[model samples]
Target: MTPTITTFTQQRVTVADGVALNVAVGGAGSPVVLLHGFPQTHLMWRHVATDLAADHTVICPDLRGYGDSDKPAATDGRTYAKRTMAADVVALARALGHDRFALAGHDRGALVAVRAGLDHPGAVTHLAALDVLPTLDMWEVMHGTSAAVGFHLYLMAQPPGLPERMIGASADAFFGHFLDGWATDPDAIPADVRAAYLKASREAVPSIVADYRASATVDVEDDQADRLAGHRLRMPVTVLQQDWGTALGFDAAARWRAWAPNLVHNTVSCGHFMAEEDPGEVVKALRGLLSR
Candidate 1:
């Protein structure tokens, strides 16, 4: 059986018309919503959420297109856009009685958190993004051979049909590849959690592809618009990432500084799954961000 965060209560919360999210909420005091990344579910925050729940009302939801959440068909370019996902997050928070809350996301969810911070600044009191750059900066930095590391991004960004079929063919191997390759510590995600991730990704191929495809198209357009309008994250921001910049030939902090003015950027010595690999560090960074 799949494990859940201790003491958290699970519920289905409607966040949009005809869409509801499977959410695990716990704790009291000020609210803090945690979003999980690609190939994972709210379960990714099992460690970090439990730690934060000691003092904060922790909200962990499987993004609309992942895990047990409702997966609407990608009818248009806007369907899986980070903008839509961000809105869902805001609505989720509002429904849970938080007019304002701290927010944190990992990987793909970080993209949504950044969009939320930009689109709904007043709703997000503080923001923390883990292991990702904004969509625009991500495309700008990846070039030539180095871009090969992100081949999956290009693959999922294709015009829908083919990408879905290809990934769906061997979903476990495809999704499991990242789980195995990105973690510095192989055991950070134990057998049960790894199995759960593979299971969820295996079942949500079309929506997952739609999510990534949106990043390549509409998501980038939204980021471009935000950049041109001189919009930056107004809330106190914290960014934790590996030293990908040194390998990719860009200044990671400088890249983040462009989008978030009040930022505390730290280079962590961990894999992509830092929250699981180093939950203490992730919790510490989030606590510091909230305190700001």
Candidate 2:
């Protein structure tokens, strides 16, 4: 029972780097681009997008390495870096006639959204990140025994080949682990949508792992450079998470405030799949960002 967006029109948008992203467009107001997280497609936004569409022109894109979007072979993880993926989103919005747009992303997409806000501050009017920390802060807090929570991050950070091969060997189990483990209500994803996620992940093992690998390496360098330059997101930013920071022994909001001067950070009781598990709260947070 995958959710459907009957009001939206779909298109294949070729970005500046020639990667064609599958995007869904709907509604009629100020533009807002929504980026879906790992192992899920733009279809993940069916609930929240439909709600936002009443007052916004919502654009949801399947990120380059996931879903039906173009999955280019990784050349040392650079291709899947959030920097590159962020550019694709900016290009997608520009191609569709928006010089600037509001942006929101969850999970891996949150990483991309953060990069987009950092790299193209002038283009992203408002930013929202769901359930993720900036790459540098993420790695900083995830150390010693705490690192075990993000074991996949370490596994994928390895030098390609082996991680891809091992994940490919049991793709369903690997993908299902996240879908099941992260969601408060596993049924929130529904069977068909879960099946779609599994299928896409199984096919894009290498590219998917490259995306994570880039977060550990190149993405960190980029974030660190920006921090050194004293750069912060200029737009109003909202971050909603499940209080992993409390469990991980870091002030999540304080950490986010370092990069987002004007930020409204809150922790939710919902699982990592906040958008699906608690669309009302997610929508409320996005609307707050939009209003700002």
Best by lDDT: 1
lDDT of 2 at 215: 91
lDDT of 1 by residue, 1-292 (tens): 2356778999889999989999999998899999999899999999999889889999999999899999999999998999999999999999999989999999999999999999999999999999999999999998999999999999998896899998899888999999999999999999989999999889899999999999999999999999999999989999999999999999999999999999999999999999999999999999999999
Q: On residues 1-292, what C-alpha lDDT tens digit does candidate 2 reach at each position? A: 2233678988889995658998899998999999999778888898999999998999998899888789888966579889999999999999999999999999999999999999999999999999999999999998778778798999999997899999999999998999999999987998888988888889889989999999989999999999999999989999998988877899999999999999999999989988899999999999988998
Q: What is the lDDT of residue 32 in candidate 1?
A: 98
The clash tally of candidate 2 reads 0
Clashes of 1: 0
Q: Tell me how candidate 1 scores on lDDT.
A: 0.94
lDDT of each: 0.94, 0.91
- Model 2 spans with C-alpha error above 4 angstroms: 1-4
Best by TM-score: 1
Itemize residue pairs with steric clashes in candidate 2.
Answer: none
Report clash pairs, candidate 1. none
